[model samples]
Target: MDTLTHTQFTEAGLADWRDLAQGIHARFATGDFATGLRFVTAVGQAAEEAGHHPDVTLTYPHVDIMLVSHDAGGLTPRDLDLAGQISDIARDSGVSAAVEALVEVELSLDTADGQTIGPFWAALLTGSTDSFADGQVRDSGGRVPLLWFQDTDAHETPRQRFHLDVWVPTELAEQRIAAGVAAGGTVVDDSAAPSFVVLADAEGNRACVCTTDR
Candidate 1:
């Protein structure tokens, strides 16, 4: 159950899904609560049959699903298979995939001593030290965004230390960046275009627009 690389996941051609930091995500528009429930039920049955389950959120208008092999720490062939099955179920149910609506957000903290601060943040956020490992904090319940520490040199106070990592589908990255710019955000860096772009708000707070294309 080795983790699949981003390139491998992309090559799978899962048109309904986007590979994000946490896993491969997808959204299907059901247009109503009953329809969404039916879709979720079918997806659940399919997941049970495959012995691999996805995180599913069914709402009045849509159903969001994320697939990941936690034991492998990322996507694997099981995820790809389940994703295809889920997409097939969606098509059979006449639910349209809304890939553009898929997004994943993560919190990043710049710190010189993650070893010291990681545990503290993990305890505060997830109430367990087990979530603090390798400079990353992850909630098994998926109740909060993933938080990772970025190693940086020791610096003075009164500087920005926290920023957001916003993950979007590859096809929507440029459009998202453009919309941010139109909303008065500045593109501080595009040296990693199609991978990530740094954007700053009017007050200079920064966030990144990320895609899996790279």
Candidate 2:
């Protein structure tokens, strides 16, 4: 399936946002045939122990799971915490991918103490005053944001947290690296072992330009 990343959460894949209020999903690909069935049963046992039964689908090659709080609209903490435990169980089973892609996270902020700074941020960003976990207000949309507030220690300049991971077809790595630097992102370093390149986004979050050969 074509995957979508909602700031690391794809509704179609594995997830971390699980609660009595929201559903979660997880997917696993096995490296060998025999391991697949065993992994499923192990997952089942784990799920039952936590009093949460995940919706499961499996083929000879891959396993996919969707979990949700049938009661809530999106996701909840219970789902994510259990997902972490399940991942640990599968690691020893030798699954093909370490874990499925994506985690859905919600960032929270408190602007009361720093009203001026907070209002400025609100003007600059899409944040709203809607309340959420732990007395923090959140962005109105279900956006995964790395939030910040007025703090004495915060860098005066906006930090670079945005980065990119680019995967080019094998032989063209260096060419693409040059093009990336020319365009905007800086090529930080090269790891030939995994055939990956780390590039910083305009904002400074590091991303990879990897060929996925490993």
Tens-place lDDT digits, model 2, residues 1-214: 1222232343424432221112444557775557778888998999889987677766777776666544454455556656777777777776644232422232333233454555544545554443222232345453434344323443434554333344343344667667778889886777563457777658666655555344
TM-score of each: 0.97, 0.37
The superposed Cα distance between candidate 2 and the true structure at residue 80, in angstroms, equals 0.5
Error of 2 at 124 (Å): 47
Residue 136: error of model 2 in Å? 31
Most TM-score-accurate candidate: 1
The C-alpha lDDT values of all candidates are 0.93, 0.53
Write candidate 1's Cα lDDT for 120-182 as tens digits. Answer: 999999998899987899898889799999999999998899999999988899999999999
- Cα lDDT for residue 121, model 1? 91
Global CA lDDT of candidate 2, please? 0.53
**Model 2 / residue 183 / CA error / Å:** 24
